[model samples]
Target: MPRKSLPALSRRMFLVASGIAAGALALPHSVLATEPEHTAISTLAFDGESLLAGGANLVRSDDGGQSWTELPAPGPILALATHPERPGLVLAGLASGGVALSEDGGRTWESRSDGLPEGEVDAVAVASRQPDMIYAAVQGDGLWKSENAGQSWSFAMDRPWLEETEHDLLTLASVDLATGMGGIWIYAGTEAGLTRVPDCFCRWQDVQPGNAMDALVSGDAPPSEAPLPAGEAVRALASAPSAPETLYSALPSGIWTSRDGGVVWSHLVDRPASAVAVHPSDAMQVVAVLDGTLQMSRDGGATWTALAAE
Candidate 1:
């Protein structure tokens, strides 16, 4: 299957991002397509017991990635996040604007963008420890949070302002690892780099060390810096709920995994990946979107098998 360009909203955001880092925005031609005949997948999530894939279409697989069944989706899905414990609770960030809540797995959906801004929702993540707590990264607007599932939302944080540009956030995730502060960490992948803030709503810090301003925030040391070269951004992020310390991030460089709660990272996959997901209960079973196709690795990333689309 040949990949195509993403929808209009994502393209527009990429154009804006190109102003700061033009090379990083040179997306391959096989990412997404709007035509129904051409299937396009950009994001993946584990719905506790099953795996959900979305972009131009939505599909669910109960038996890992061996088989799939198409599911209902409001529109082109930009991102997806499912509750770690709630079997059927899912959140989908739409390319159109706002988000949709699906409680009956992906079979049904309801609009849940009450307080969100009118722009594409780039990414969304639901807290594992607190299923009701959620985070969304809106395109033009910054990040938004919801305490009561997706009933409503409020501003949580602003996008990173670097090099005179407010970098657009491309992905978001809420990791359960304790931050020594009052809460876990909420991370966002932007055009600039990977940045995170303790749920305490304190200050945001880059995952890469050596920031003079970060020194004045607290004595707490920064998490292990990701090995991405300067100007590379994390394009997608996923962390295991059963093992909060385990994290997988997809970037233009490739896929990287962290076992010590983002303290130490090791490159796992060498090719660029658009999205990644770990089984909610089993961290070793992983799936990633490579060149707009689905690939699964049962023993972490030691090996991989491409899954045929149904």
Candidate 2:
């Protein structure tokens, strides 16, 4: 579902169902008092102490989801990823042809797009085992890599399949890091299909076709009113820190999980979510940010509770 077409539910209803209202109400007035009335909570990433969200602007919550403080960045953030080893290091992909890195949590940011082709940075992720290395999916430009943090970057792969389709790399995720290779496994979701890129090679192999890619490739025309196909545009990808092989993809229709990399997947959740994040410390505790609010699943996406709304 496009962020704009989400159903309008009352803030009270949204908060009550998500079980975040009670926690948010307990937060100090200073932190919860200055929310931007018009902001939409688009993407979410956690740094242990605070939940960082990127949307129309950036916002952070020290007290769970009860209260929030705006942390404006230079541009609209399309994707957000936290370094697995570095507690505060964060990479933000911008809607424009740019990328930003934050060393002090998200309090500050700096642009780092050297050598990257001109295009929107659709996705961003850091090596869970190697925090210094980062990867990005540049729309129309293919994949890029930054070996030394975000100071500099180089094209990692630009396969003919990616270039010929003229599709943007909308989502990217690192599958496993236990192997010696810094980025052993990668998944790239494009308008054409999901591309599975292993560490040994630079070319991407297209996975099975589904509505998720079709919707985005066909311009948001969901196959069904039931949120299945719409949830597969590869809006978000997350790998459980505790179970590296367990990967989750946030598609337009719903959430899908794969226990053995991207070879097979099963539906995890049916809600239309824009982004999903796993608790770095607990895989069972995950959060999904939708167009108007947030959802939490304690049992690994078996069920969901709404948190808040615009």
> Which runs in model 2 stand beyond 4 Å of their true positions?
1-39, 159-166, 177-183, 206-232
Kindly report which residue stretches of model 1 are placed more than 4 angstroms away from their true locations once superposed: 1-39, 208-226
Cα lDDT of model 2 by residue, 134-232, tens digit: 998787677888888767888887743654555567777776743213436677666555665655444455443343333334455323222223213
Strongest candidate by TM-score: 1
TM-score of 2: 0.76
The TM-score, computed over Cα atoms with residue i paired to residue i, of candidate 1 is: 0.82
In the range 180-278, model 1's lDDT, one tens digit per residue, is 244477877887777777776666775534431345265555544554455788889888887977888888778888887665678888887878998
In order of appearance, the predictions have TM-scores of 0.82, 0.76
Q: Which candidate should be chosen as best, given lDDT against the real structure? A: 1
Q: Rate the local accuracy (lDDT) of all candidates.
A: 0.72, 0.64
User: Native-vs-model 2 lDDT?
Assistant: 0.64
